[model samples]
Target: MANEILVLGATGKTGKRVAERLQKKGIPVRAGSRQGNPPFDWEKAENWATVLSGIKKVYITYYPDFVVPGALEKIQQFVDAAKNTGVQQLVFLSGRGEKEAEEAEKIVINSGLHWTIVRSSWFMQNFSEFFFLDNILAGYFVVPKPKALEPFVDLDDLADVVVEALTDDKHNRKIYELTGPELLSFKDTTSIISEAINSPIVYEEVDMDAYVNTLRDYQIPEDIIGLMQYLFTEVLDGRNESIKNDIEDVLGRKSTSFREYVVKATQTGVWNIQNGQR
Candidate 1:
């Protein structure tokens, strides 16, 4: 029987791309989602065994955020289940400068499963696909992060590295710290967006409380708001300034630049389509 790989959070930003890339390489892939057949749900332990059946490898991406409450325990439980189910390898999509995420990575490392940790900084897609999209379309981006300079990693690059780790044994037992080539503050990031979209876009640095209130006004859940606060206040406190060469080491090339990301995202009609920007 051919080895089957399970991709957790299959519909998410990175997971979607990883599934596509793996399928393009003609590898068997099982989309592990609540909606998929033999569905997998992180909150539902009953579905785990069935979804893990016949899966030799896994690309684990926890939804919302990995640093949220109950993530570490859930990850440890999943790791145990995967190992017991005869899974041979695992690749986790993790965040940079997240102590909780690092602890979760440690669980995977000690799981006795061949593991590769893709610790990524802020995603470049955050502007094009996630929270920042609405702000970009609104002609102004607001956030609490002002001085933080993040080397926003490209989702494409992250997905490619994940595919590599799944198909090749060379990446086993390694932690890949992925990020873009250049550091850019929120102000600089807005400038890049303006340049790419050929329009004037502004960035406003509000206090952390104001940002939280804005999210509250939008009816975002409290837990998610807490996660955002933790990221802006704790994780982005100059903890990830140094760039790593993991992209070059794993993919044998330099990581994508933010300028390239802006241009490519523009071409994808990401910024061009202003409707439902979120």
Candidate 2:
């Protein structure tokens, strides 16, 4: 009967959307992140105690990814803390096809808390909110192309699912693999956006080493580079190349397509060139 929901990573792509939805429904939420109440920092154990106080449920979205080294340990510790601090329900935003992420999911499953796993595919918002946005604006988005296709899930869809799990007990102990309606290669994704915005954009496929070198040139952190490598090498081996129906099963409607997302985003003028740059 705990009504308070603690949304960790509250400023992130899905967490922000989840918080907005919860607030709209008049649900009580404690925004957990450096930008909000109690200022949750993943590396700071001291921040954990206060953030979990008076919280009956938690929505956990680990930053940078759950596959990087020590992520499993961190999630285990965080879940243990949540259990000890009166948090009874946990909804985890999990990465699909990530071995380490799967391990983290297991930790949550074994916890005393009632849990739901929102195992998700690549997010379509990466183009608008993350590093890919700058690349998209610059007209050339580069990546180490995965041979297997990715069905990029919409953040809106993800938020919808997360909200459902956090609010409903029926979703407890279930794992929902969230994906879009269609499979797309990296090139196809950029092409769709180009068509949507009525502007030319290109997808440049680099070898894994080349992508690593590019990150190195920018002095991107080693841990981040490790993630990029893991994603490109391990997760993209066609294991998760297919679309999943779990979103439709849970939300009772087909998840938004990439094309639909791009069209909607286009209307926001987020892709419009600004101040002589994108």
Candidate 3:
């Protein structure tokens, strides 16, 4: 029997790619977004019951992140509802080095639904598809952590691992710490970006307070600024430097590197749009 999978955050970075990959593989995917029929909104309860009507499995990617406000409460509520609605499996996309995220994982694990957790490192796409894009386009990549090294994982690998967990039962109850094959400093990561795009992109390091101030000046939400500060100071401080073999363990191949991500994204013209040359 083909399972119906509900994908929360269906329009976001990893969720979109996972949904597309599933569809291409002919998996039945119900895109759970505010725009879809029987829309799914994390903040709205009425929409939840409708979206999980026939969903036997769920790929849970919390928007913004899993550590944000009321996320644990919301996740608990969703799990209870999913159990009542008879959801058989649950896959959560989580962040590494987050205690709150770990707590949320525990909630889902004990939710009476089969569960798997993908604890991810910083995404390689952040430079090209996320907050750093504007900075890169403007010819500089400024960051809060000057000395932090990240094994930035590729979203393609993440999507693949997610699809495997959703479709196959072997991955049930396992926690996968997913990271890239090489550890690179923010400066080194940006250097790859420069080489891939054939342009010189500079990396500038600033203190967390300064970065937070800049975010405030830009009118970024206080909650988001807090999270970014936490991630940089608390999570990125030499804790995730060692490269892991989890990708090979899960997907039977070497994980994608920073350079690979830059090259592929550049070829896709995403960087061109960022450079304002489009």
The order of the candidates by lDDT, greatest first, is: 2, 1, 3
TM-score of 1: 0.95
Worst 10 residues of 3 by lDDT: 269-278
- Tens digit of lDDT per residue, candidate 1, span 165-254? 999999999888999998889899899888877878877888988998887876768887888888888888889987888899889999
- What would the C-alpha RMSD of candidate 3 be, to one decimal place? 1.9
**Candidate 1 residue spans exceeding 4 A from truth:** 273-278
lDDT of 2 by residue, 55-141 (tens): 989999998887666778888889999999988999999999888788889999999779999999998988887767766787877
User: Tens-digit lDDT track for model 3 on 1-278?
Assistant: 35768988889999899999989988878888988777889889767888898789999988666667788888899989888888999999988878888999999989878999999999989887876776677677777865568889999999999999998999999999999988888888878787877877777788888888877866778877888888887888777777788889999999998888887888878777445532
**C-alpha lDDT of residue 89 in model 1:** 96
lDDT of 2: 0.87
lDDT of 2 at 32: 87
Candidate 2 vs candidate 3, lDDT winner: 2
Off by over 4 Å in 3: 216-221, 273-278
Error of 2 at 34 (Å): 1.3
Q: In candidate 1, residue 82 scores what lDDT?
A: 91
CA lDDT, every model vs. true structure:
0.87, 0.87, 0.85
